[model samples]
Target: MTATIDTMISRLAAWLSRHSIDVLRVSLGLVFVAFGTLKFFPGVSPAEALSVATLEKLSLGLLSGYAAQAVIAAMEVFIGLTLVTGKLLKTGLVVMTGALAGFFAPYALFFTDLFPGAPTLEAQYIFKDIVLAAAAMVIAARALGARLVPVREPLERVHELRERAAA
Candidate 1:
């Protein structure tokens, strides 16, 4: 029974990796869509005020207010659609990564506000993007079949040279 259960668990893991990855992708896309849609109307998203403030501060006043917020919302919606539809998933990952970089700034820029006592709701919310970013990385890796290797790993060229020398 134990052996049978172990086999089933292994199969389930494989099934999730092979057939259910898209589920994760779509769910993340839905999250982006919901957040972006919320931004379309004022005071709908809890993160709106913080987002606007962060954007203004990051852009040094060049971008702010409803206009800047609208632009961000549109971007999130576009990326979300791309992921949801599985069209240009790679490009969507790139865009998502870039957007998350901006999003992550608040964790540092507003550290005091975010962590005055405990992390405020806004801070906690913004911080969740890190996990989302990590999820995106995994999705992108699976989508691309990326293999992670150490930086000091020997290059293919070196291996080829060694083979030639042996010959």
Candidate 2:
């Protein structure tokens, strides 16, 4: 059992490294974009979701509520853009690490009381940020730069290649 677990872990790690930064970029970018959009829902502003008042009470008043909300929004948009363009990807991942950590900190530390009724919404709103934060950390460690190689290929070429190979 132990040997099998080790082998599985090794294989997973190898696969993770082989696929590289685009995986991390796409995952983190989509998550931030989705969460950021959700923040605009009724009573669900970034400041509210982040428990900004709690942070202020904790003497993290240096992060102004409005500024914090703006930063969160900006980070989400910026990370999404970077991932799409494959530009300055490493720095974007590093910034994403900070943004995701900020998104998760409130639930992880202060708001255990607020999590029972809507399990899936709660999980996505809270735990997903934590998981994505870890992913950002992993992506940061990989240190992906502005990707020079084109990431996506048009679908037409794939079909053409298959036809030629079959012939």
Candidate 3:
């Protein structure tokens, strides 16, 4: 029974090691596309008002209202496309880094509004970006030739796998 359980766990881990990063990347892309699509239509996205305001402030009033929203929407869609298609992924990661900075800016700029006493819904919404950022980091590392090796795997075996993957 113990051996069976161990075998199951190892199989599950191996499967996750193979597919988790791709799944995360694709799902993240889909999320960006969905959210960006929402901004295209007014009164559809809950984050619409805050997103516009944040962009306006970030852009020093250069972008506002629908224009600001449009810029954000376009950026997100572009990121989504690159990630989903695995085309221009490095560029997408670069853009993602910048977008993440913008996404987190509100926490520093509007601390009081986001957290007057208890956390507001807006604060909660922004907090979820932390997970997205971490996932992006993982994807970026993988893109840069990093691989996940099981702990029990031998170092020589891992090197062989890396060599095979590179070739």
Candidate 4:
């Protein structure tokens, strides 16, 4: 059982190294672009309410309605474009991280509404951004030639990577 699990893990890692970055890049790019595009048409995106409300609250009610939604949509599109083309990757990752951070805000700020005993599907949806963030972080770190790892010695290696990048 242990050997089988190890074999599977090794194969998965090999597959990821061989092609997963491109796949993740394209898939995430498409997701961002498609979802953002949908925001242009009213009544399409389900998260419109949650998103706008979160933004309004974060912005102290300064941002609300379609105008605020449009900005968010534009940011998603920009992140998608950069990721899809593999250009301005650092910028794209930064924007993506920021966007996901916003998506994560509901769990923190609206704990009661999002989690009255059990979290709503909406909260689950927002929580999935953590996985996306992890994927993006992997790709971003790769783009920077920085190897953060679950497999390798992170403490020693990450320090080495930072020192190398800094030099």
- Per-model TM-score on C-alpha atoms: 0.79, 0.53, 0.86, 0.75
Model 1: CA > 4 A from native: 1-7, 147-167
Model 3: residues with Cα > 4 Å off, grouped in runs: 153-167
- Give candidate 4 misplaced runs (Cα > 4 Å): 1-16, 147-167
The prediction achieving the highest TM-score against the true structure is 3
> Compared with the true structure, what per-residue lDDT tens digits does model 2 show for residues 129-158?
566666666666556443323333344565
Backbone clashes under 3 angstroms, per model: 0, 0, 0, 0
Can you rank all candidates by lDDT, best first?
3, 1, 4, 2
Give all candidate RMSDs, comma-separated.
Answer: 9.8, 12.1, 7.7, 9.8
What would the per-residue lDDT of candidate 4 be over residues 1-167, giving only the tens digit for each residue? 64466567666776767677777887888888988887777678888888888888888988899877887899898888888888998899989888988988988788898888888888887888887888888788778886433363334565577679999
Q: Each model's C-alpha lDDT? A: 0.81, 0.61, 0.89, 0.81
Q: Which prediction has more favorable TM-score, 1 or 3?
A: 3
Alpha carbon RMSD to native, model 1: 9.8
The top-ranked prediction according to lDDT is 3
lDDT of 3 by residue, 1-167 (tens): 64566567678888888889999999999988898888888888888888899999999999999999998989998888888989999999999999999999989888999999999999999999999999999999999999886556554565688679999
Query: Relative to the unseen true structure, what is the C-alpha lDDT of residue 35 in candidate 4, on a scale of 0 to 100?
Result: 86
